[model samples]
Target chain A: MKIETKVEKFTEPLHLESGRILEEFELIYETYGELNEDKSNVIVICHALAGSHHVAGRYADEAKPGWWDKFIGDGKTIDTTKYFVICSNNLGSTFGSTNPLSIDPSTKKEYRLKFPVLAISDVVKAQMRLYDRLGIKNAFAVIGGSMGGMQTLCYAIEHPTFAKHYLAMATTAYTRPWAIAINKLAIESIRHDPIFKNGFYKKDDLEASGLPGLAIGRMAGLIAYLSPGLFNRKFGRDYASTDGLYELFGRFEVEKYLEYNAYSFPKIFDPLSYLYICKTMNIFDAGRNKDKLADSFDKVQGKLHLISFSDDMLFFPEEMEEIRDIMIELGKEKQVTYKMIDSKCGHDSFLVEVEKFKDYVSEILKD
Target chain B: MKIETKVEKFTEPLHLESGRILEEFELIYETYGELNEDKSNVIVICHALAGSHHVAGRYADEAKPGWWDKFIGDGKTIDTTKYFVICSNNLGSTFGSTNPLSIDPSTKKEYRLKFPVLAISDVVKAQMRLYDRLGIKNAFAVIGGSMGGMQTLCYAIEHPTFAKHYLAMATTAYTRPWAIAINKLAIESIRHDPIFKNGFYKKDDLEASGLPGLAIGRMAGLIAYLSPGLFNRKFGRDYASTDGLYELFGRFEVEKYLEYNAYSFPKIFDPLSYLYICKTMNIFDAGRNKDKLADSFDKVQGKLHLISFSDDMLFFPEEMEEIRDIMIELGKEKQVTYKMIDSKCGHDSFLVEVEKFKDYVSEILKD
Candidate 1:
C-alpha cells in the first residue's frame, strides 16, 4: 500500500437494486481543469480499465498528461483552455481512489473481498457527487475509451442532464460470452493460485496468485491491447541473444519483456480492484431498460459519436453497430454516428498507432 | 498419454553440429505420390508447428486431408502421379511421434523434460530414413510452409543430393527476433508454471502450467497465424452480445471461437516438446549457405522459388527480396523467382488461404 492519505470520500448510504445494499459506500475521485464561472462548459472524461482521475497534470511527479495524454492536452481534443474538463478515478480504482482495497472504516482493515459488488451505476453515482459538489448543471461532453466508453454511455442515459455530447471510444455496452470466458480464466488463475489462500492471505504473498495472476491477467489484457501483426512484427521466432556460441540454454529477448512487465504489474494493482472493475464491466447492461437500449437512448439528450477500431477484438465493431442501430431506431441516428479507424494494432491501437488516433481525435474536436 | 505402441525409431543416432547427443530418434510420417523409375522425382512435403503425418488420408474422425491435404493430393502441388511426397513430423513432436512425453526406456516413466533437444537436422534425418525405406535416390523438390519452410531450407542445405527443387513457402531461413520473443514468452509461461514443476509433475496435476501456458501459448502463436486487421474487421470492440444490454459479464463470439481452438491445443501438445522445438528453431541458421542462396545460377544445384506475403510480419517481403538478391547475384534469377502475395491474413494465411498457397504450389511444380 503506497499511502496517499490525500484521498477524500463521500458516502451514498444505500442504492438498492441488485438485492444487496451498497451501504455507506465511500466514493473517491480526482480532477483536472478549472470550473468555468457558468459551470456549463464542463467536459467529463471517463477513464478506461486501469485509468484514473489523474488524466492530466502532476500526481507528485512530472506526470505525463493522462493515458489519453495526447488527446486531452492544451488546445487538443478535450482542450482545457476552452472547457472545464473533469475526470475521476472511479470508486473501485486501485489509484488513491476508494476501492475494495480501501479500509472499511468499521473494521479499520482493508476491504479486500468483503467489499460489495459494484455496478457501472455505482461509478456513475460517484461522478454525480463531484458534479453536485462543483454545482455543475450540465456537461459539454462526456468522452471515454474502452471501459471509459461504457461509462460515457451509462452517464448519458442515467443522467442525461450531465452530458450534451457523448463520445464512446473502443467500448462495448456489455461483456460478451467470449470476453467473459477470458476474464473468468484470468480470475480462475488468480483465485486458484496457491498464494491467494482464498483471498484471506496477507498482502505479502508474492509467490501466490497476486504476481502470477496479475501477470497472466495483464498478459490476457495485453493480448487484447495490440494487434496480432504488431506482436508478430515485434517478436518473431528469434531466440534470446547469447554472448557465446556454446551457450545452449538461453531465452529469446521478447520473453524477457513480458516477464518484466508481468512481474511489475502485481505490485502496482490490487487483485480486488481487478475483480471490482471486471465485475462492473460484466454487470453493465444499458439495454436493461423497458425498450432496452432504444429506450435508454431515448432518455439521452446528446450528440452521440461511437468511434471503434477496425482491429479491436475486445469490442468488435459488430456490437457497436448494434448499439448504433438501436440508437438510430430511437430516432437518434442524426445524433449518433459511427466511424471505424483502420489499423493493425487491435484494441490498443487507439492508444498506440498515434498518428491515426490523433487524426480522429482532432477531427472530432475540430472547430 | 494416449498410448500408440506401434511408434518406430529411424534406427540411427543423428549427428548434429552441436555436440549434444540425441541418443536415438524416430520419424512419424505419411507418404503421397509415386517415385519415378529413375528415382529422380522424390518430393518432401514438410509440415509446420502443430501439423502431423495424416496429411491427406482418413485418420479416424479427422476426415479432411493430412496437414497439407490439398496441396499434395491426387493432382495437387506435388502431384502423386509425377513425384514421391513424404511428410514427416519433427523429432521432438507429440503427434504419435517420439516426443519428450514418450516413455523413456531408461527411466521407465515418460521422458517429459528429460528429452534431449532435437534440431531441424533431426527432422531431416528421420525423413531421410523414410526416404531410404522407399529407396529414393534423388528428390525433385522439397517444400513447406512457415516452420515447415524452415525445415525445407534445412533439408536443402544438409542433403543437397536429396532435394534438387526447393519451394520455400511463406517461411524464413532463420527465426527472427520477434518470433523467438513470442515463443520464449510461451515457453516461459510453461517453465514458470509451478505445475510444470520445472517440466515434470504428477500426472494427476491436470491444472498445471500446461493448460494456461498451452492455452496462451497457442493463442499467442495465433498472432503469427492471422492478420490484425482481419481480427479487428470481424470483431472490433463489438460488445459480447447481440442483445442491447451492457452487463459486465462474458465474451464475444470470436473470442469463443479462439477459446474453442485453444482448448484442444493443450491436450494435443506437450510442454517440453514446445520448448524443444523452439530450441531447434533458435539454433536454426540459413546463413550457412549464403553463396548458394545468393547465386541461384552458380554452385547451387537446385531450383528455388521463394514466396512471401506482403502483410506477413514474421517473414516479411523484404526477406524474400534478400533471398532474391542471392539468386540475382548468382545470375540464377531465372532459376530462382520470388513473389509477394497480397493478403489481410498474416502468416497462417499460407495454410488457410488455399487458393493462394495452392496456386504457388502448382506454379512451382510446373516449372
Candidate 2:
C-alpha cells in the first residue's frame, strides 16, 4: 500500500473556455498496478472538490492512506491486482496540480487570481492529455463521484469512445441553482476576508491571513456534504464542554466539528484556488448549447452508469432520475444502468458507502 | 396603514438563565388595531431572527411596508379589524431593542460582546414583561412563525395560562443539530470579518466595516430560508446578464438575489446582534429539564396549533409530526391541531403564503 506521485509537463498551451490560455502546465498523478502489454485494462479515476490525486495507498510520512484507499487498493472493489488505475490531481486544484498556487512561469510568482478560470471540460481535457502521454489509447472505465462524477460525464461526452465505461455517482449533468447559491456563499466568504487582499495576499502568510474566509467556506461545504439525519444521530444538541466552558462560541459538538475542520482547511488549501474551483462548479452545464441533455449524450458511446444517493441535497436523486429518463427516451436504455443508494450520508455517501457499491463495481468491471 | 415604534423602559433588572443580568433595559414594540375592554382580544406576535418590531403597516417616508404587513392589516389574515395585535423585537436584536448594540447606561458605550448571552426563555420573559407594562394580563393568542414560532412555543410553555391559544409555524420545540450547524456558519462568518475587531468595531464604521462578514452570514441564512424547488422555479440557471457582463460574479439570478439581500441586511443589522440572536436560537430547547417533551407541556392549558412547511429543510415537517405524536400520546390530541402547508418556499412559507392560511386562521380565531 505504497504510493508515489509522478509529474508530467505538457508544453502545449491549454485553451480554456474563458478564452484564456496556460502556456504550459504539469499534471501530477498516481498509478496503482502495472499497465498490461496491450494497455487495455486501464481505469481513470477522478477526484472531487478538496480531493487530490492520491486516491489510494499512503505516501511516506503520512498518517492516513489516500482518500479512496478503502475503495481502490490491492484487493478492493477496483482491484489494483487486475487493472491499472490512474488518478490525477485536477487542474485548478491545490494539490500537486498546476493551479493558482503554482508558480507562474513568466513571473516566477504564484498565479493567484491571475490563473485562468477553468471548466469541468478543461479538467477532463488535461486528464485526457495525461493518458495520451502514458500511451493509454482507451481507458476500460472512467469512475468518479460528486465533482468527479461531473468529470466522468464530461470525459464520455467529449471523448465518446475513449472510455469503454462511464460511472458517475452523486453528480448532475448541469449545476442546479441550489448548488450555485451555496457556491456563491463559499466564494463570497473568501473574497470578503480582508486578508485575502483580492487574492493577492502574501503566499507565506496565506494560511493565517485568509484562514477565516477559507474556513468559513469549507464549513458551509461540509454542512452541504452531510445529511441532517446524520447530524441528528451523530451530534444532536450535544454540548462540546461538560464544564460549561466555551458556551458562548463553541457550545455544540457540531459547531466544534465544523470549526476544527474549517480552521484546518487553509493550512493546506489556497483560498484563490478554492474560489476558482468552486466557480468552475457553479458554471458547469454539460448541455449548454443543446436543447435537451439527451442530445449531448447522443455522441457518447460508452456504457453509462448513474449512481445517486437518496439523501443527497446537492445533486438530489431526482436530478439523477432525470438523466436516466433522458437516456431511456433516447433509446439508450440498454447502454445505461441507474442505481440509487439509499443513504443518510448525503452527497458524501459516494465516498463513504464503498461497501454498498462493491458488488455493483465488480459487476461493471467484469467485462 | 400607519405604524409607529414605541419604547418602554423597565428600571428593574432582568435576570437571565445564564446568571447574567441586564439592568434597566428597553423593549421596542408596535401595536396594530385596538385592545378591546378587558384586553381579552389581545394577540401577542413574536418576530423572527433578523425581523423587527415593525410587523405591519408603513412608517413615515418608508417605501416598503413591514415584514408581515400583508397579513396584519385591517382585512388580512391576522385581521386588525377583529384582533388587537402586538409585535415586539427580541432582546438580543438590533431593532430598537436592548441588544449588544444598545448603550450601557453605566459605561455610556455600546455593550458589544459584553452583552450577556441570551436564551429563548429570556426573550419570552422580556416579552411577557412588555405585556405586563401594556396592562394586558392575558393574551387571547400568541402567534408566530420560524424563530418567532419558537417564541410562541416558549410563551405557551413558560407562561401556560398567559395565553388562551398558541400558534407555532415552521418551527420545532428544540433546535436540531442541522440548525446549529447553519447558525455556527453565520456566527463564524461575522466573527471572522477582520473589521468586526472582536466586536469592538467603530460604531460609525459598523455598517461599512462589518458588512462583508454580516452579508456572507445573511447569504447563508437566506439560502437556508429558501427551498431548492423554490430556487429552481424562481431563478433556475438563468444568468443575470445574457451578454455575459458579470461572469466572474453575479452570474446566476439566485446569486444576484442573495447578494442584494445579504448586502442590504447590514444596513439595518448589527453584526453582534446577529451573532447573539442566532446563538439564542441555537440553545433554544423547550423541554430542557423535562423527562419528556410532553412533560414540558403538561402545565399548558391552551389550544395548540402547529403549522409546518412541507418544503422546509431547517424545520422539517417531521419535526412538527413529533410534536403532534407527543400531544396525542399525552391524550391532548383533542386540544392540539397540526397542519402542513404544502410549499416550495421552505422556511419562508410562513411569511410568503399568508393567503393560503386565511381560512385556517379564521377558523382558529373564531374561538
Candidate 3:
C-alpha cells in the first residue's frame, strides 16, 4: 500500500502533566485502509521514541517500506485492510510533529529546549485530540511497543472506555531504575556534546560537525535494543578492518555496524527532541500513585494485553509479569493477558522478531 | 596486612604483540604477609581494569582499605597470614604501572595513543618478567576477574607451568560483539569530547574542565557492571530531587547514583589509559587462530577454574560453559572446572559478592 502523511493543526492549549503548556501544536499522521461507516473498526498505533506516523507502506521515493509495514498492511497480522489504522507522530518527537525543532510563534525561533517536557500521557492527550477532530468516539484497539507501549497504557487508564483492546508490547507500568539509568547515559552523552550548545546548536552546524556524542549515545541505545545472543551470532569477534587487532583505534565488525547506524541518526534526528523524548520515557508512570498500582486497573474497561520478550533487557518479562500480577490481584485477570515471546532480539523483538508475535496478534484480533 | 605499593624498574626493552616496543618500563606491586622458604605458597593476584596493585590492607592516610581487602587479609579467604599475596598493576592500567600517562623515553613525552595496543598476553608476559626479576619460578595460584581473568588465562596458557591453579572469574574466552559494542560506545565518548584535544590535552585542563564525555562513558560502563535486578531493588523509581520529575533534565535516584560515580571516575582515572585498556579487552582472544580455541589449551599444565556469575551481562555463563565444553571435548575436563555463582551483582559479583564465593575458594585452596 502507498502512504501519504497528513497534518492537523490544533489551536487549543495543551496542559501537560507537569503544568507546562503547549499553546498551539500540529499532529502529523498517516492512515491505512478506510474508516468504516460508524468508525467502529479504528486501530490507533502509538509510535515509539523514534517512530513516526509512517507505520506502513512507502512514500513515492522512499527506499524502504514503513517501520511496521510487515505487521500492518493488507491481510497482515494487524490487518489494515479490514480496520482503519491511524498512526500519529508523537507530540515531542522530531518526525514532522510540532516538536522542539518547530518554530515558536512567540519568539519566532526554534523552541529547542523551550519545548515543554512532555509526559507519555501528554502525548496520548494530543492523540486523543486528533481522534476527536477526526470524529472518532471509540476505537477497536490501541497498540504499541516500548515508549509507544507506555503511551498505550496511559491512554487506556486515562480514557477507560475508549479502546476495546489495549496491546502494550515490551513495556512497563512505570519507569524503573535500570531503564532510567540507560536513559541517563543517553541524555548525558548529548549534554556532554560540545556542539550541543545546551540544546541550542543550529541544525546545520550539528549536521556538519556531527553530533559525535549523540552518535555515541545512539550506540549505547542500540546495544540495549538487541540481545547478546543475536549480536554474538551476527558479528562475533570479527574485525571490520584487516589490521584492527594491531591498532589501538581498531574497528571491530560490531563497532563498524554501530558507528554506521549511530552516525546516520544525528542527520535525521534532533538532539533536543531525542532528549525530551527520553525524559518523557524516564518519567512515564502509568500508576503515578505508587501504592495504588492495582487500583489503577479497577476502572479499566478494555482487555489489556501486556506482551514481553523473554530476553528484553530494557523491559524484562518480569516487569510485564508484575503488571499482570497486579491486574490479577485486582480481580481484573480476565481483562488482562500477559504473553511472553521467547525471543533473542531483546527490546526490538516487537519490531524485528514480529513473526513470533504475528500469530498471537492474529489470534487476538480475529474478531 | 598493612599495604604499601612498591615500584620495580626494568631497564630491558619490552616487545609487544602489536610489534611495538616499550623501551623501558616499571611494574608497581604490593605484597601481603610472608613468602614461604620454597616460594611454593605465593599467590599472584592480577588486577582488573581500573584496579591496582594494592588489593588488600590500608595505607598510612587511606580512608578505606584496598579493593579486595575483604577477600585477602590476615585470616581472610586468601589467608595472607599463611600465604604471601602479591597483586601487580597491569601494564596498561592507570595505577602506578607503566601506562599511557607514563613518559615515552624516546620523545620525552607521555605515550598517550603512542602506547602500543596491548594484547592480554603482552600484559601476562610483563608480569612474567616481573616474576623473573623477583626470582620466582612458580606460584600456588594465579587468581583474577574481568580483564584480570583474561590475564590469568593468558598467563596459564603462555607459561603452562607457572601456577598450580588458574582461577579466572567473570570473564570471557574472547571478546564478543556485545562487549565490543559497549567498548566502542565508551571509546567513542572520549574521542568525541571537544576537550579531549586528540589525546594531547593538558592533564590540568582535563581535570579543570572535567571529561564530561569520559564521565558519560563511565556511566555506560557502570550500567553494564551491575545487574538490572540490583538497580531495581537499590534505586527503584525514586526521584533524587523533589523537582526532578517536573524538569526536563531532572535527576532520578538512579541517574544521581550514576552521575555521582561516573563524574568521580575522571578525577581518579586517565581517559587515555581507559581507551588503551578497553582496546586491550576488545582484542583479547585466548585463541587468536580461528577454530583453534581448543588447541590453545593443548599445553595446559595446571588446573583451570572458570568462575562466572549467573547474571553477568558483560560475560555470560554460556561463555565460560563454552570453554568448559572445549576442555571436555579434549578430554581435559578433569583439569578444567567451571563454577557458576548465583548473584544479583552481575559481573562485579566477583568483587562485591565475595561471601557467596568464599567457601568455594576456601575449599579449593585448602590443599
Using lDDT as the measure, the top candidate is 3
lDDT of 3 by residue, B7-118 (tens): 8988899898888888899889999988788878889998888898889888779998889988999999998888888988899888889999899999998888788888
Residue-pair clashes per candidate: 51, 0, 0
Model 3 Cα lDDT, one tens digit per residue, A57-176: 987799998899889998888887788999999998888889998988889988888888898889999999999999999999999999989988987888989999999999998888
C-alpha DockQ for predicted model 3: 0.85
List model 1 lDDT by residue over B282-316, tens digit each. Answer: 66667643554443224455777788887675677
| Cα lDDT for residue A114, candidate 3 | 82
lDDT of 2 by residue, B296-327 (tens): 87766788899998999899999988988888
Chain A TM-score of candidate 2 vs. true chain A: 0.96
Best-fitting candidate, measured by TM-score? Answer: 3
lDDT of each: 0.68, 0.86, 0.87
- Least lDDT summed over 10 consecutive residues: which range in candidate 3 chain B? B204-213
**How much is the lDDT of residue B162 in candidate 3?**
92
CAPRI band of model 1?
A: incorrect
| Model 3: residues with Cα > 4 Å off, grouped in runs | none
